[model samples]
Target: MQPAFTRERVGVHAADMVHGITAVTDAWQPGRTVDVSAAMQSVTARVTARTLFSTSIGDQDVTDIQHCLVVLFSGVYRRMTAPLGLWEKLPTPGNRRFRAAHDRLRGLIHRIVRTHRRTADAHDDLLTALAAAHGDGPGDSLSDRELCDQVMTLLVAGTEPTGHALAWAVHLIATHPEVEARLHAETDRVLAGRRLPELADLPRLEYTGRVFTEVLRLYPPGWMFTRTTTCETELAGRALPRGADVLYSPYALHRDPRLFAEPGIFDPDRWHPDRARSVPRGAFIPFGAGNRKCIGEHFGTVEALLALSTLCARWRLRPVPGAEVRPRPETTLGTGPLPMLAHPRAPG
Candidate 1:
């Protein structure tokens, strides 16, 4: 529960999709880039199961976990948005399902923990990391409940954003053939068809990262971060009031004409650190900058880059016929129909 979602899990988590891509690619044998949404799903499921439970799960378990996530998120939103006088005694079927999801997730994780402890070969995956990371910090580890809660958090947080980001990246790359072509060229130049893109390949993937940055800007997975005022302070010269709820909207910030030369255009080069330096601190926050920013930013970024680069290293995505990619705003803005198709990239 107390395990800090660190950079380490990305490698283990990546193994899931790398396998999925190989399986999918071999089946289609496409010569151009193959859209790897199915592969992305595999990675997302793997991250949730492996990161939280420190175990592997089947396709059905992954599907069940996603269903649980939907319920849990909906329940949270309902509780937050419910009327003040609503009775707690009344629980709907949906709430029941939600709680069941929560319970199932908890039960599954603890069983995995117990199983791992019993086994001699408990490998150094996230569960192993959590087992080793026992004390809260130095001498403190999480309690069983805390571990379950943290695992639950990872199940939801680890999946939704990365999944949506993958979808967005695919849609963006698919529709913009020029951008897609550039990405294909970039991955080829950087990796030269080495088995898969590794953490080592990330530094060489500057523009690939920018594609993610720009995509995050235009379609941020964590679209709006909200906070209630614990202490009053001025923001943008506005007088602050205590207890005021505020939202930081990256969508608005990313598209502001004053900050971007052409906000609507898909331009990864704009994120070149030299050019990026000019944007105001709060204005450029795709992952939210500074202390209170998301813990998963770097982790998620790396995961997305690896997934995108790995998939692009082999397959191409193009628009699906009659499919409209419209933004459905919820916790994250998901593009509906995910309007894309995958084809294999011919070797350069």
Candidate 2:
């Protein structure tokens, strides 16, 4: 799975991201209000489907997936916040809905895996790579069930968080004219009148990259995660027994004044190479740390950089007047129903 998301492999999927962003931008009309969150989610979902399965999933399928995710994640949040796990065992309405959504999503993934296995070598995508991978031991080979589980994990991880982070970037750009101006300038200079950005142009879009890094720092999609101690450990002079469940919030860590100057400000320059190194290790863990770090980190970053550059190049999305735009922290920190009007940018 890690090999499937290496920088070189991820670069092969750049065209998929370009196509997805084009589809979204093509549907946008001047002054038409678009749900930025939903639109970003649709773009990422399409891109992930193509890159992961070597097939295009219909708009309706994306919608169905999103609906199931919403139901399932809300249930997870409930279980996480509750004091005891006993309620989860009960067949309550919430629990029932969660189980149904889980089954529905799993069934879809299983069908996809079965279909892909028939023509495994015909396609060049993540599924094919995983299917062909082998190791020394027989147990190293993935069973159908294991493959389905891996795909489900990648689908959820690759789609929702990246989409939500892009939505936050769009919102931040809309509200902060200074930041938006800088972003547009960088894209215009790098793209030089091109309608779409290519993987080669990533190096020149440095500011665009910083903007996204800042976006992640401010509004990381995986807002909170829980880790269990494998062995007894001590933290901040407190002793912890093995198997202790410790919950931490990247959302809170990113806002600490000690790690970042004026932490609440939407300043991209803070991510500049010189300043970026000033932040201590373990202070920035938007994608977790150690072996548990996200497998798709580089892939997600490329998708975001390309998508943001593509959108910023052709149009500016402005929050609709009087619309309330705020973070809605669920499974991911998403901006729920973010209505923004697309204004075409004047030619460079």
TM-score of predicted model 1? Answer: 0.81
Q: How well is each residue in 141-188 modelled by candidate 2, as lDDT tens digits? A: 888898888877777788889999999999998999999998888888
Clashing pairs in 2: none
Query: Number of clashes in model 2?
Result: 0
User: What lDDT does candidate 2 reach at residue 281?
Assistant: 93
Write candidate 1's Cα lDDT for 133-171 as tens digits.
Answer: 554567687656666666677677777778788888888
Runs in model 1 deviating more than 4 A are 1-17, 20-41, 53-64, 70-97, 117-121, 128-141, 236-238
Off by over 4 Å in 2: 56-101, 133-140
Supply candidate 2's per-residue lDDT for 270.
93
Q: After superposition, how far is residue 217 of candidate 2 from its true place, in Å?
A: 1.2
